[model samples]
Structures are given as structure tokens and as C-alpha cells.
Target chain A: MRNSFLTVVIFAVLVSATYFYLKSPEIVQTKLEVLKENYSKPRDKKPVDHSKFEVLQKQFNSPQEVVKTCMSCHNEVHKELLDSPHFRWQRPVYENGRGVTYLGKANAINNFCIGVQGSEVSCNKCHASFGEEEAMLAIDANAENIDCLVCHDNSATYLKGNNMNGFPDKSVDLAVVAKSVGTPTRDNCGVCHFFGGGGNNVKHGDLEKAQFHTTNEIDVHMADNGGNLICIDCHTTENHNIKGRLFTVESSNTNRVSCTDCHTELPHESTVLNEHTVKVACQTCHIPTYAKVNSVNTNWDWSKAGKLDANGKPFETEDSLGDHVYKSIKGTFEYARNKKPDYIWFNGTAEHYLLGDKISEKETLLVLNKMNGNYNDEFSQIIPVNIHYAKQPFDPGTRMLIQPKLAALAKGEGAYWQDFDWLKAAEKGMEASGLPFSGKVDWFNTVSYWPINHMVSPKENSLQCVDCHNSENSRLAGLNDFYMPARDKYELVDTLGNLMILLTIAGLFAHGSLRYYFAKKQK
Target chain B: MKEVLIYKGYERFWHWTQAVLIIFLAVTGFEVHGGYSFFGYENAVVYHRYAAIGLVVLIFFTAFWHFITGEWKQYKPTPQFVKEQIEYYLLGIFKNAPHPTKKTVLSKLNPLQKLAYFGLMVVIIPLLVITGIIYLFYRMPSATNMNPLNLTNLEPIAILHTIGAYLLVMFVIVHLYLITTGHTILSNLKAMITGYEEIEEDDDHHKKEEKKV
Candidate 1:
């Protein structure tokens, strides 16, 4: 009875401890929430005369506010900032705007710079550090505009001065700027462009190391073509406005000059052209468009359209276009919407449509050159002319340049035109004969194009080899005109007949070896 | 004296063949698992796969022979020396002690040995074989279906195979050490070679011998 009581007492203590342990997490969470709610909604209570705290806050605010106050005198710098791509961003909002977010907008920058862009709150902190001294700015007034020396000053060494603080008032703290200015390093850029957050997406491939601020000795992209180009080179301020040029191409809607504008040459060497010549234009292939492709996020509903039922019946039909139609259908009348490539099959129109007038090969080259001038960086296309000419005599207006056979043939080709050379043979043959190759080449003709296939099907170039030759025919054909050439042919017959002699010898040797082994075993 | 060969020539042949093959597999298996590179990784994988297949075939044949010869009775574990044998390995081995039980033609293994061998044959080997075969024919991921072979973490099967190999290696190290602790230092090794062992006659065994005479 005593032992049982002791066990019960121990069990009671364990149960109490366990109950408290499980409840602690919830209790702590509730207390933390309560504190947060109280702090967020500050109420008017008994005012304490906190003079010392106010003095400390004033000192910090005075020096930091210098950048904003100086902006009044240096109005040019402020104007240039308006033209920057950063202007697209609205003031840093907590979670609403499309700017950088601290909670991390899905693919955008992190939460820290949610409101600010170029001259926004966070950027101004580090950027305006060079314009600290009034005497320095008086000597070179333009230095206050960009102040590239703040970060990129390579000859700089550590020194002592005011650490700027505050947003609007102009005052300087005396104690903190006491250290020497360290050598300009990539770490300076890392202050903004680390891990691609905070609205500063400086792409240099190797994100672990900051490549923008410092004179990165090693070219991250092209080791050989490494030039001493700074951010201002690509991002130049025009009209006292920190603005970059934007291309008028229908594709790129944003404001910024493309790197390809100056560096007309591709970073890597082109396979088709030598170093001296320019071959394929970059814009012709990787053509940019202002509108994004495939804008719809979800699948479509087709049940709402009022149309005919399967068997000559009228009903409601909802096509993928999101439009309702009431119709009657007896035959399989196909429909297409949105001009998507796959939807073309149901359009009931011919395969492909042409756009422009047909031009000769020489004219095509001239037109290409005209559309894409030597220095101009843009893409041009003459789709209608080229497409119509390719499918000749098919009522060029009504006939689409749909190469049904060509599309089927091109299916398994590697990314580049794999079987283009083979297809060129047929094109060349027709061109050489100067005759019209009327219809498309069928599957059989495509496969049986080889010379070996021609012998098999003499009528259609399939693979038949024994059509003209046999052993009896060979003998007759060899003796030309039946004249005195029979001795060589008859004597040469032993060459093909030697296999019988060899087999007889092999059989005898096998028989003798077996007999000897069996006889020895018996002994 | 009735002359008794505890192990037959074929039995020893199968024993050594399996041991050598298992050791080869373990070495190559570790190399394939990127533990270290003695042979190149690809070659080691090929060699390990071939050795594993041969070991499986050898095990199949060995099991068949054991059943046919009624030698499967040798692995039947009992309470005989169950505690003493555990004590022998745990503490008595260092003191130059005699074995708790003797090996005879009828019963060559102690209870501990029987249980370990039975566990290895029934549990570990089957697990390794089944997992290995499934891993070898694993399919690529598809749009319609998830990965066909669903191992817990998608860790490469070679890692699991390497774990099995390490377990086998530990077993081998203990086995080799045990083989040396016989009537004489090299007596067990020699017995395996000559199919005979000079077992020391204890008081009970000697009395039984005299009674038989």
C-alpha cells in the first residue's frame, strides 16, 4: 500500500510538469501578441520629459538630412533622377506596390526597399555620402550629382569625419567618421546589390561577389574583352537628368539603353562569320516584343456557347474564345480563336497565310539591308512576300505558304535545320531544270531519294538490287559479242568453288582428333 | 578414435568463394558510392553489379546444397551455451579463455553464431537483394505518374548498398578475429584447409570417448 502511494505521488508530479510544459508555448505566444498590439497602437499617456533622448535623436537626424536639403541647391541631380527607370516605382509601400518588398515579392527584390527606387530612402543613405563636405562640392559642383567617388574612389584611404544621419535637416555627427576611408572594393556594391534584393538587381553572374562598385579586374563575362567601363558608361545622365536611352522597338517598353546598341558584336564569336565580318543580326532571331506571349493564366470554359449539337441540331455552344454563340451545324465546321499556332488547324482556312509582295533572291537581300541599316539595331520581317513566293501558282492571295510535307519532315531535326541540306537537293533540282515542281513530295519519295533505293524499285526508286543481274546473266554478259573471252571466265570459276575443298579437310581433321582422344581414353 | 571431418571440401570451397566474392563486392561497392577512388567510379559500379549477381547465384546454390545434404540442421539455435557464448565474446576472449562450446561434425556453430547467420540470411540479405533489384530498374520521372520507385528520400540506392556493405565488413572483421581463437592460433585456418581439426578433449568429451570404447 505504501509503494502504491509513492508511485501515485510521482505520477501526479509528472502529470503537473507535463501539463505546464505543453501549455508554455501557447502562453508565451499570447503574451508576445498582446505586447505587439499595445506597441503598434500608441495612446496618449502621461508625458515624461525625456530631454536627453530628444537631444540624441536630434544629433543623428541633423547630419543625415543634409542629402535631402542639398538637393534644393543641386536641382540638376534631382531632375536627372526623374528620367531614370527607377521612376516607374512608386513610394515604398508595405505590401501593395510593385516595388521591392521586405516580405519578398515572389520574384522581385526583398522587403527592405519596398517603397524607394533610385533616390528613395535606402539608396540615398549610401549614395549621398560623397556630397558631405560643402567646400568639396563648391570646387566641383557636378561632383554632387553622381558622386562616383563615394564608392569607386580607389586611391581613398581611411579618414575621420561626420557620419551622415537624418532625412531632411543638415547637421553632422563628429565622432563616427574617425576611421580612414578604405580602398574602393566590391564590398561597396555589396552594400546594395547582395543576393539580388532591395530593388538593386546588378547582374554579374557571380552573385556571391559584388562586381559593380569596384574596378573588377577580371571580366566576369568576357575575360579577353575586359574593358574599364563603369556604371555611368551604360547608365549616362542626359539633360542634367539621370536618364538612360530607351529603344523604340515595339518589344522593350521599359526605359533603358540595351548593351547591344554599342557592343554591336555578340559577346561570343559567331560560328558562321569570321572576326572581320558581321553575319546574322541578333535582333532578327531573338526579336523582342512589347506584349508578353500567352497572357491568359487559366484554361477556358467552352460549355456556354450556344451552337448546333452533333446531329444537325441547334443548341448553345461555348468555344474557347469565352464568347457564347447560338448556331446550327450539320457538317464538321472547325473554328479557331486568338491566332495561336495550334488553333490554326481548326480555322477551316488554308494552312499558312502570306503578307507581302514576292521578291527575287537579289531583291530579298536588298530589302533586308534596307530594313536593317548597317548601324541600326532592330528586327524587320517580309513575311507575306517570302511566304507567297514559296508556294507558286496556288492563287498567291488565297493560297497560304503552308508546307505540309516540309513540316512533317522537319519534326525530328535537331534544333537547327538538320535535314535542310537534303531538302535543298530537291529545291536545287527543280531550280536547275527551271520547271515547276507542282505538288508536295510524299513520304515514299522522301525516303526513296537515295541511289541504292532506285535499283530496287526501278519505277519509283525503291531498293531492289537483283533486277538486272544473276549468275546465268553474268556469264552471258561477261563474254562480249561471244568472242574468245571464255577461257578466262571458265578458269576463274575455281576462285568461287574453293569453299567445298576447304570444308572437306576441316571435317576429316575433326573426325581424326575425336577418334584419337576416345582411343587414348579407352586404353 | 572416430575420425571426423567437420567441414567437407565442397563446403569449404563454397565458404571461401562466398567470402572472397562478398569482400570484392564491398570494396567495389564503396568505391562506386564515392567513398574513395581505387578503381574509377564507373568500372567499380560494373564490377560490383557483376559480383552481386554472382553472390546471389552462389547463395541460391549453397542453400540448395544445404537442404539436399540435410546440413540445414547445423544452423538450428538452442539454449546450449547461449549465455556462456555471449560472455565468451564480451569478456572471456581477452583472458585467453576456452570456448563455451565445442565444434563437432554434427553441430559446428554455437547458438550465437547460428542466430547471427540465420538473421543475416533471412533478413539482411533478402532486404538488400530486393532493394538492389528495384533500384537497378528504377524509371525516369514522367508527366502522368510520379517516380515509379519510391524510396523515402530519393537518395541514390548506391548509398544504401554502401551501408549494407559496411555492415557486412563489420561482420567479416569479427568473423576473422573469431577464426583465430581456436585450439591453437592457426588451428581453425588449417582445419578449413585440411578438412580436419584437432579439438582438445574436455573432461566430459573424454569420458564419453572412453565409454564408447
Candidate 2:
């Protein structure tokens, strides 16, 4: 009977194994082949030939002339560009169905340069619309103001002047640039966005010029040897409205671009990992460390600015990473390389303190941009972010952070950079912003958070279980919202469990021995 | 005393293979849990998975062999002499008292041995195998996206698997000590190796019948 049962069981197992071994692979292979076939085909659209456009043949002396020529063919280009936040430098925010305030680089208060109110000339170097006259142009004006070459130019010669009020340098050949205009490449967009906070790899720790051609290990998606995806691939745009946000003031508008738009909510094969996506952002694991190529400015002490050597010449010192740790003109800086991001619960929306907002005097640390979410919020995800700290000027009386006219030093105005005079610079900046400034100027520590959106490591390089589940020195140790298994333990439950296990073993041993002893005594 | 065939060749092969696989699985599994890093995390996980699969295959084969050879009956629990067998190990053996149950080729395991082996095979081993297999393929593509089993966390499964492992470890420790309770220290060990054990000439009927066979 047992032999027959064994034979039947073995036969059943063999049959099932054979079925799966032969059938499952064929099914999976067919599906994989279909997917591969779909992906391998190139995009249907043909590349535009810029050489054929006769309007770009003429020599242009000014950036305005180049814009005028571009508008000749693409007549409605200015209308589209005018509506874009890149051109306007402001986005309208609605509060309770009413337009409250405009937020962007035009009005946003940041730890890095504070505000663009007084530093329009230096800050607007990255502004899309060209010429100083364009800054004053009416919102609905039909004029040659938009700089087409800033994004579309392929000549690589279009260099924007530092103080030229959004105009390119005269040394650039405008005709060559105008003729070579094509689709925006990584280099074109990176020229301004990559070098955001004064210099290359200064502001956002994740973004840098090196991302244009990085190794797969550094960024699996953007790297040339990896996915080789363009910015537009994920940030799919519609009618010139790019689907992304800078680390500026909060806007009422929702972002169209997200990782889930391409990858889906449950991208991971593991069910446990897929579940983590609900409360953990994709970048938290994918981007293990930021600033892979260069060290990022972690802190800036504006109070230490305007320091000079014995010869009266401005001095600068380099950090261990060859980055400027201190410069007499700007401030003392702290740089960090391959930094692990500070994780926080973030929803899509954020709240930012605008310029001239009255802050608490007792509050030493002021948040420039506050992510709107908490542990209880269903929409919140644990996102990795880079926090840039700074000590900047503030009004002692009103306790409001004062934006200093640091850029006005170049124009010989009442700037902090001119004579290291904080009160004069603060007064001028407050006047430009049309806000009342107290005579007494003080410094306050502030933090500005920039969400890490780049430098994605390969899947294999992602953090393991114990990375966050450890009791000590864990990345998620600071996060007390959720109970992590290995990292958290209930004292009573642990003690009881240990006691039970100990008692069970002891009881079993004692029972066996005592029964034997009694039986031996009776014998 | 006379030599009699006890463990068969296939039985011995199954025993040794299962022993080695279990030990390998335990070492690698514990390392993967961050207990201690020997082969590093990645390598430990890989080896643990392989050993688990190997054990699963061995289990099926051994189960089939045991049923086919009519050796499954050896592990059938008999209440008779169970107390005596327990007393022999705990106190009787120490006092030089005689064993209550005699060892035979057909019924080699004592009543206490039957109970322990039954618990291990029916409860603990199955628990370990089921949980281990679940963990191994939990990340497989087919198991993901609309997870039917709702295996959203590894914590619960991991805890269960660890408990099963501890039980098996305890069983192994007791088993190692029990082998020393034979007539001679090396007697049981020699029986498992050479497939023969010495038994007292109790029945003349079996002695003449064995020689004739």
C-alpha cells in the first residue's frame, strides 16, 4: 500500500514539474519578445533640419535682433513663451478661489541669495526672455523679447552675460547661433538650471553638469551607458509648460511629471518593496547618495563675507574636496560630497515663507520652504532631500528676514558686498522689495530644502534591510513615525516571549528527568 | 552479540544529505539575517536559497523512498514502553538499567524517538520548508502586483522561519547526545555508517530464519 502511494506521489510531482518546465518558459518568452519588439522600434518623427530656414541666414548684432528673426517664422512663439513661468519669472497662486500672490524667483525667499528683488540683474541672467527692456514689457505685449537661442541654440556659443540684463555676450556669433537652433539638448537646459545657485554644482546636490555624460553606477536613468533618457522623456511637457518645479516659493499648480508617470506605483517585483512605494518615494532608495561628481555647498555663512587679507585683496580658501570653502566676496561655505539625504514625509504640495513675512525672534532656525505632510497624512511619502543651511540678515524689530542687496556691489550701490555694511544693504533691499525694514539688522539661521531628483544609483546598489532596520546608526533612525521591526521592540512583549521559551525548555527537561527518577525509585 | 542490517544504503544517503543541507541553510540563512557576515550578504542569500531548494528536493525523494521501502512504519508512535524509553535516557541508562524496548530491523526507532521524529517531520520541518519557499520566491515577478497572498511584509514570515530554525537546531543537539546512549559510545555511530548493529541473541527463531534467508 505504501509503495503504491509513493509511486503515485512521485508520478504526480514529475507530471507537474514537466508541465511547468516546458509550458511556463514558452509563455514568458513570448511576452518578453513582444515587449522587446515594441521597445526596439525608433520614434516616428523625423529630425528638423535647421539649415533650411532662410530667416537665420542674416547676421544679428543683438539678442533682440535674433529674437525678431525667430519670431518672423515662428510668430506665436512669444505668446507661448510669455505665458511660461520661465519667461514671466512668476507663477500666480490662488488661495480659496482667489488669486493671492505671485510666486517664483521674482518673489521667493531662499537661503541662497535670499530674494531676486534687488539682485534682478545678477539673478535674471538665467531668465528665458532677453534684454532689460523685456523685463518692463507688458504681459500681453507682442514684441521680440523672448530669447529663442537660450534653449534651442546648438552652436554652443550663446553665452549670457553675468550683468548684461538677460542678453548674451557680444562676443558670441548671433547668426551662427540663430542658424544652429534646434531642439534643446542637455547642455542647453543645464547651462542655467545645472549652475543655479551662483556656480556649477552649488545649489542642488543631485544635479550637476557631469550628469550629461555620467556612468551607469552614478545615475541609472540619465547616464549615457544606462537608460540615456532626456529631461523631456520623464518631464513630458504640453504647450511650452514644462512639467517640473524649481526649489522656489510654493505654487498652487500641481506638477504633471512624476516617477510613477513612467514606472507605475508598483514598479518593484517584490511585493514588500512594492508596498513601500505607498509611503516611500522612489528616490529614497534609488538615489542612495547625491553629489556624485562634485561636492555641494551644504552651508553658507553670509556673516563671514567681505573678509580681506593684509594686502587688502579678497581671499578665498579651498576645502578638502577642492571646492571654495570661503571667499571674501560671498561668505564662508561648507561642502559635502556623496551626501546621504535627510528623509522627510512630503506630499506634492509645500508651504514657503514669502519675503517680509514676520518670523519669531525666539526661533533660531527658520524654514524657507516647508514640505506639507506628516506621518498621519495618507498622501505623504518619505522623500530624500538636501537641506542647504545659511545665516542671513534679518530685521531685529519686526523679526523678519531681510534680503540684502549683495549684487549691487558691482554697481557701487549700498550693497553688503561694497563695504560689508549690513544695515545699508538691508535698507536698500527692503526699499526695492517695498517692505519696511528695521534699523537694527541681525542674523538668523535658516534652512532651505531641495528635493533630490537626480544621481539615481543602480537597483543593485540600493540600501539593504539592515540599513534602516538597525537599532543604532540607521538612516531612518530619526524617523519615529512608523514602527520598523528590527529597530523597534516592545519591552514587555520581548521579556514575556523570552521567559516563555526558557520555561518551555526547562519544563521539558525537568519533567523527563523527574519521571525517570520516580520510575527508578519504584523499580 | 551479532551484527544485523539496520539502515539501508538509500536511507543513509538521505540522512547525510539532509543533515549537510540543513546546516548549510542555517548558517547562510542566519548570515542573511545580519546575525554575522561570513560570505557577505549577497552571497549568503544566494547560498541559502540554493540550499533551501536542495533540501526541498531531498525531502520529496526521502519521503518517497521511506514509503516505498516500508520504512515509514518505523516512526509510528507506540505508547507502550514510551515512558520506559524516556526513563532509560533520563535516569535508567545512568543507573545501568536494561532498555525496555529492543531494537529490530523492522522497528528500529524507540517510542520516544518516534514521537520526536514525528514532530520534526510533521510540524517543524514543514513549517521551515513552507516559510523558506515563500521567502525565496516572494520577490518573483509572478508573485508581485495584486499579491493574492498579501505578503506585504517580510517581518512576520522571517520571524516564523527563525523560530522553525531554532527548533531544528534544538532537535539536532538532542539527537547528537542521544547517539552516545548506545551499548558502546561508538556503537550507534558505527551502525549508521556500516548499516549494521549488534543485538543480543534473544530469539532462536529469528537467528535460524535470518541464516536461511
Candidate 3:
């Protein structure tokens, strides 16, 4: 019987060993085949030289003149641009399968500079449309108003000043800009996006000027030494319609660009890891921390605006990280760097609080964006986001949030920045937006969430298992809908388990000592 | 005085190997649970998984050996001597009274040991093995295929595995102390090491007489 048992054991061990050993060769062969397929793909050819174009040789006077010349050749481009969210500044919102309202920068109030209703001149600095007057121009009639050089200019000289009617500063050489027109580079996009909310590295935490020529440590995909990819690589655009969505006031029907477009769902080598793709977003793991290069504004208290130094001049203060913590024209700000993101289950859909949305007096309103999803939703994935908090103005009597005409002071209007007068600015803003506002003014807390989608770290720097799994102060600590091992515990089960262990140990000692006493007595 | 060979070489090897694997698994497993961080969380998880695999392999080999050697009968439980064994441990041992049952090469386990070992081997060990395997491959099949188990919810399996771990810990503590209950303090420990045990001549004579009757 013993010999038979030994034989069976040896046979089982040999079979298992043989099976694994045989399986290794096939796995290695498949891996090599996959690697070959990945590397053998054709490389991209160089872009067409704009210098060869005959029409670009002529000298242009104004930025508008440069656009007219480009339109003469690229006729259909203007029509496509006119239909885009960049040109319209507003997109139709559909709720419950019915078009409800057009939400965008034009009318939607944000926690930042409020809205563009009474401040089109200053706010239109980032607007894709040409001229401050173009904001009032009919969307279909402004086909000629699309500023082509804003995105297409390869010349580093093109510069747009605040309230310059979307044209470059007077000193900019339009002739040089027209001649150097090409596909948008990171520099062109970052000119406006990186300096959004009044200064550099202020709005979006992940975007900054440093990203244009950054190392792999800053942004793996956009790194000059690494991927060296341009904005068009991921934000693939066709017919002037950019394939991306910003979590702003705008309601866009356009599809948001996702990492999965290039990297498939099962991008990871481990099958176990690939399974996490179901509930965990690719960005959640890839971009472990946002604002890697610079500190980003996390909070803005508008009530603290209008502070003056001893010289009676508007004072500005810096935070510990050298980011602007207080700008008298703006507010008291809080900045954070290498900021851990707040996680949420997002279903790729967001709802915005429009200009006139009635807010509750008890709870702080999510004024900018709210991710729409729950744990039960199969479409949802755990995504990292940045929540920017603000204390902004609202009409207490009207029971509605008000948009303060923040930039109206630049135009010598009765704006909040001019006289530190909330009522006058709120009235002017409401009038420009065509909404009624009560004379009474009050302050309310608000929050805006921006999804962290950039500054992807290398896989080696990705979050470890215990980072989110084992601690009460974990990233997903507030997410109570699902049970996570180590992070959560059942009280009854833990109590019983500990009790059983204690009892067993006590019983063992008791039995041993009793046996020892009896043996000693017998001896 | 008489000496009897009880444990075979393979049996002793299997027992010691299994003991080492279980101890390693428990220590690393507790660290993985954030009970105490000794190996660090990442290393603890890796070591725990490897030890669990080692234990599973040992269990397979030991089970095969037991069945083929007919040593599986050692754990076959009987209620006949169970009450007396309980009484002997509780009262008779303190009074220096005789044991409830005689130990033979074929029937080496006491009634209490047979019951406890039966439960541990058949229920608790299998429970831990199944749950651990489920957790190790929880994220299998990738995202391409619809996972049949839908292990998106891992709480239930984790709870079961932890419970099994607790039971195993309790059993080890009791087994460790029970080793000191032999004729001399180190008798059982020495017997396990050398595969031979000393039996009283008077007990051996009484067992022969009773067998003849």
C-alpha cells in the first residue's frame, strides 16, 4: 500500500511538471509573435510643407485677412469649424431624448470667471472665433470668422492679447503666420489652454507649457524624448471637428477621445490585471498623480478678492509651492502639486449646473460638472478627478446662482472687479445672459470636477496593491458602495475569529499544565 | 519496555513540510491582511501566494500517501472512546488515572484527534484552498471575454478565506500544546522525529490479554 501511494504521488507530480514545462514554449512563441507584429507596423510620413503653397507667399495686413486667404483655398474647412463647439461656444443639450437647452461658455456660468455674457472681449481671448463681435455673430453667418492660425500656426510668434477681438497682438507678423500654417502643435494648443483662468498652469492641472518639451517623467505620451506625440495624435480631428470633450459648461454630443482608441482593453500583459479594466479606468492607474510639473488651483474664495496692499494697489501672494495663492483681482486660492486625485465611478456622462439652475440653500452645489454613475452601472469605471472648490456669488432672493461679470471691469463697465460691487455686476451679467436676477446677493459654496486624463506615469510608477486596498485613508476610502478587502471589515466575523483563536490557545495551555501536574504527582 | 515504529519516513517528511508551509502562509497571510507589516505589503502578498501553492502541492502528495498506505484509517472517528477520552483529559489525567484507549500502529490517533483532524483536512483546508485559488485568479479571462464568475465582487470569497485561516491558526496552537501531553514532556516530539515511541510493558500485556479474550 505504501509503495502504491508513493507511486501515485510521483506520477501526479511528474504530470503537473511536464504540463507546465510543455506550456512554456508555446507562451514564449506567442509573446514573440505579438512583439514582432507590434514593431513591424509602418511609420508615419512627414507632413506636407506649407512653404510650397503659392497663396501663402502674399503679405497680409490683419489676422482676418490671413483667414480670408486660407479660406479661398480650403473652402469647406470654415463650414466644419462653424459647426464645432469651439466656434459655436455652445452645444445643444438633450435630456430624456429631447433637446432642452444650449449649454456653453456663452451662457453657462462657471466657478472661474463666471460667464462670457458681459465679458466677451476679455473671455474671447481663448474663443476659437475671430473678433469679440463674432461672439454676437450668428453661428451660420460666421463661417469666415473661424481663426485658422490659432491652432494651425507653426510660427512661435503668433500671440493673442486679452480683449484683442481674437486677433494676435498688433506687433505679430500675420504674413509669417500665414506662411507657417500647419497642423496644431502642443505649443499652439497650450497657448490658450495652459494659460486658462488668467495665468499659466491655472485651469487644468495636467496641462502646462512645460508639457510642450517635457521629459518622459512629466508626461509619458507627450514627452519629447519618449513618445514625442503631437496633440493631433490622440485628439484625432477630421473636418475641423476635434475628437475630445472638456468637462466645462458646454454640452457636447461629440465622442470623447479615450486611451483605448490606441491601446486595446486588454493592454496589460497579465490576464489578471486586464480583468481590472472592467471596473477600473486606464487613466486611474496610469495617471496616479495629476499636476506633476506644477501646482494647480484647488480652491478659490471669491469673497477675499479686492484685498489691497499698504500702497493701495491690488496685492498678490504666493503659496509654498510658488503658485499664486491670492490675486486681489481674482480671489484667495489654494494650490496643490503631485495631487492625489479624488476617485469616482464615471459613466462618460456629466451634468452641468447651467446659469439659472435653482440651487439648494442647505448643500453646496456642484456648479461646474458632476460625473453621472453608480456602482451598479456596468458602464461605469473608477476614474480619477480633480474637484475645484469655490465660494461664488448667488442671488438669495431669486433662489438662483448668479454669474458675476468679472471681466466687465476691463471694458470700463460696472463689473465686480471694478468697484467690488456684487449687485451691479450680477445685474449686468444677468441682463447680458437674458436672465432676471434679484437685487439681493449672497455667497454659496460650489465645486467643479475635472477628470485627470494626462501626465500618465510609467507602469513602474503606477499605484501598488496596498495603496488603495489596505488603508482607511486610501484613495477610494469614501467609496462605500462596494466592499474592498483589507480596506473594509465585518465586525461580527472579526470578533468571532479572534475569540476562537484565543480559546484554542487557552485550552491547549490548560490541557498541557493539567497533564504535567498529574505526571509529577505520579512520579 | 517496548518501542514501536509508527510514522514512516515519507509521512514524517510530508508532515514537516506541510507544517512549514502552513506556518509561512499564516505569517505572510496575516501581513497581507494589514495585521502586522513585516515583509511589507507587496512582498507579503507574493510570499503568501507562493506558500499557499506549496501547501496545496504538499496536501495533494500527503493525501495520496495516506490513501495508498491505508493510513487514512487513522482518522476514522469512533464515538466509543470519545466520552472517556474527554473525561481522561478533564479529570482522569489530573488524578493520574489510566488512559481511555490503547495506542496501536494501525490506530495511533485518539478519538478527539481523529475528529479534529477529519474536520481540518476535509472541510477547513479545502475551503481555504478553493477560496485562495479563486482570489489568485480573480481577475482572469481578461476584459475581452465575459467572466463567468463575475468576480467583480470579491468580498464573499475573501471573508471565507479569512475564516479558514483563523481556524487553521487555532488548530496549530492546540496541536502544538498537545505535543507536550506524552509520557515525558518531549516524548511525542521525539517520537515524530525518530518514528519510534516507548510503550509501557504493563499496558502491552493487558492489550495482549484483552485481544486473546
> Against the true structure, whose TM-score is highest?
3
Model 3 scores a TM of 0.87
Candidate 3 lDDT by residue in tens digits, A1-523? 4864675477457646744553343222234345435534543443767777888787887777788888888877777777666787776765322257776776566777777877776788888767766775545666667788888888888887767667678888888888888778888888888887777767788888789799888888888766767787789888877778776653443478887777755676554355578778888888889888888888888878888789767778886678888888788988888999989887766677777878776666655676677666667778888888898887888777787776752535867666667778888888877889989888888888888888988778888767776765777897878776667777677799999888887777777777677678778
lDDT tens per residue, model 1, B1-213 = 233677886677668778888889867765544325666544565566666666666677678778988998778666656799888765565555667777677667777989888877876687667667665544322221323663332244544543455556656665776676666668888888777887654468745633332
TM-score of model 1 vs. true structure? 0.29
lDDT of 1 by residue, A1-523 (tens): 3643453465446545644553243211223334335434533232432222322233323332433433544455644433222321211222212233221111121111111111122233443333323211222334334332234333233221222211221322311221212223444434433323221221111222323332222231211223333344444445433323211101122344443444443332321111111312222122111011111111111112124347634454445644332222111112222111110000000110111222332321111111111111112111100000010111123221112111112324311122222233233333322334334431110000000000001112211111111233321232232111111123222333234435544644554455446546656
Off by over 4 Å in 1: A1-523, B1-3, B90-97, B142-160, B200-213
Chain B TM-score, structure 3: 0.90
Q: Which ten residues in a row have the lowest lDDT in candidate 1 chain B?
A: B138-147
Q: What is the C-alpha lDDT of each candidate?
A: 0.36, 0.74, 0.76
- Rank candidates, TM-score, best first: 3, 2, 1
For model 3 the local lDDT of residue B187 reads 81
Error of 3 at A403 (Å): 2.0
Query: Number of clashing pairs, model 2?
Result: 0
**lDDT of candidate 1?**
0.36
**Chain B, model 2, TM-score against the native?**
0.89
Superior by DockQ: candidate 2 or candidate 3:
3
